[model samples]
Target chain A: MSHFTETEIAYMQEQKLGRLATVDAKGNPHVVPVGFRYNSELDTIDVGGYNMGKSKKFRDAGRHGRAAFVIDDVLLPSQPRGIEIRGRSEAIQQGGKEILQNENVDAEFIRITPTHIISWGIDTHPYHPSSRKISS
Target chain B: MSHFTETEIAYMQEQKLGRLATVDAKGNPHVVPVGFRYNSELDTIDVGGYNMGKSKKFRDAGRHGRAAFVIDDVLLPSQPRGIEIRGRSEAIQQGGKEILQNENVDAEFIRITPTHIISWGIDTHPYHPSSRKISS
Candidate 1:
């Protein structure tokens, strides 16, 4: 099977907002929405957000490598769908001076290497259970 | 001061999606998009999701009483905004027979009682940092 099932790939392409979650020093969970894209060449998700370099989510990810990225939409009037991925992550500048949409700030990027996938809906029939761990 | 700033309340009303983060037994953080409502009466956020009772998030909340719910939007075209609330949580079937739209399932409800609120970019100016502990 492919890294991402065809349906999952399609869902990611259509959704622009995803929440990247990480843990704090006290182990409290933190979730924040981000603008993201699936980088096909690297086969991983790349996320960038406004003022993200100074955000707590950035510091948390730097300290804690594991994260969960979820992209979901309930606006379709029907079939609320989402794709959830859990993996190790790192806050990286990656490839020199990536800029953000907001002025005067550099791009904040978190690279996720997924270990498992869990999803619901995002299909014609809808709400089928499709969760699996990636076998390296 | 009000528990929710005027700006935070408005943002919650406009957005239909929120990301809920909970910690698993291993302390791995899990985040999922949820359809939620800010119940002004109870001053809590109640969440319902697809097959949520059977989901890990539900179990995580059941075993652990802390969760963070974040709702964000970049729809304004120029700025991205988010509201993050930290609180204790639990999976409850409260008031008996809470129904799920998908049929044959009682509603899987997760309730979040906020202890703190952190937000940025929910105002006219956008990206203004607003973080405060809720006065209990």
Candidate 2:
């Protein structure tokens, strides 16, 4: 099952980049810009990088085992909407696939399986924000 | 002692918004779109909102007490650069001052005091990506 509504998926498809946040061993937060592609069947977002093998964030996720990814757009001065995904993440070198084509990446990936999602705008939900569990 | 270089400050000043990542009590990662103002004197960012006092993110910030804020701009497909701030944070109903001008906000706030910063593409450092303490 897809973890996102079609509306949310379409929005994610349109965005070029998202930011990812993970924690180090001491629980300090770390966030960085990432490019990702959503996999419909597996219900995941695959974030890949060229040097993922040695990246601090990739290592941080190894220890923390959880992450948050966010992407947003400002339709106008006061009209803005975005999505946030809280999920389990693992840095990997294979079983990777492409969703958005980027010439900057190859092979290694951070696989995020959504646990919770919060979204607003884009007509998916009203009253500013909505949250839901991806699954049990 | 400022946490950011002049280049970083300038880059941040040019960006409209950023994403903030915090964790819940259960160590679940949470991220949200946040509009913030960088305080040069205090070397911190004060994030204010209209209903911040009642938002889940605000409550999460209260529980986590730490956060990561990220702002990135992709000049081109391969030229990606941005900033990351790992900091101490607190949600507050008052003592919030404004630095960035926005017609959308008032009242409650979340304050983030940077302990470390990581950056690339903005030329804050000589390396492609650099990490350093807030103070020299």
lDDT of 1 by residue, B1-136 (tens): 4488776887787777688999999888898777777767777878876567788888998787889999877655667677889998989865212422334443778889899888877753456758888767
Q: Which pairs clash in the backbone of model 1?
A: B65-B89, B98-B107, B121-B127
What is each candidate's DockQ, to 2 decimals?
Answer: 0.80, 0.75
What class would a CAPRI assessor give candidate 1's docking?
A: high
Residues A9-114, candidate 1: write the lDDT tens digits. 9889888778888988888887877777786776787777656677788788878888899987764676677888888888886431342233444466777888
TM-score of 2: 0.89
Which CAPRI quality tier does the interface of model 2 achieve? medium
Per-prediction interface RMSD in Å: 0.8, 1.1
Q: Point out where model 1 deviates above 4 Å.
A: A96-108, B96-107
Return the top candidate by lDDT: 2
Specify the highest-TM-score model's number. Answer: 2
lDDT of 1 at A44: 81
lDDT of each candidate versus the true structure: 0.77, 0.78
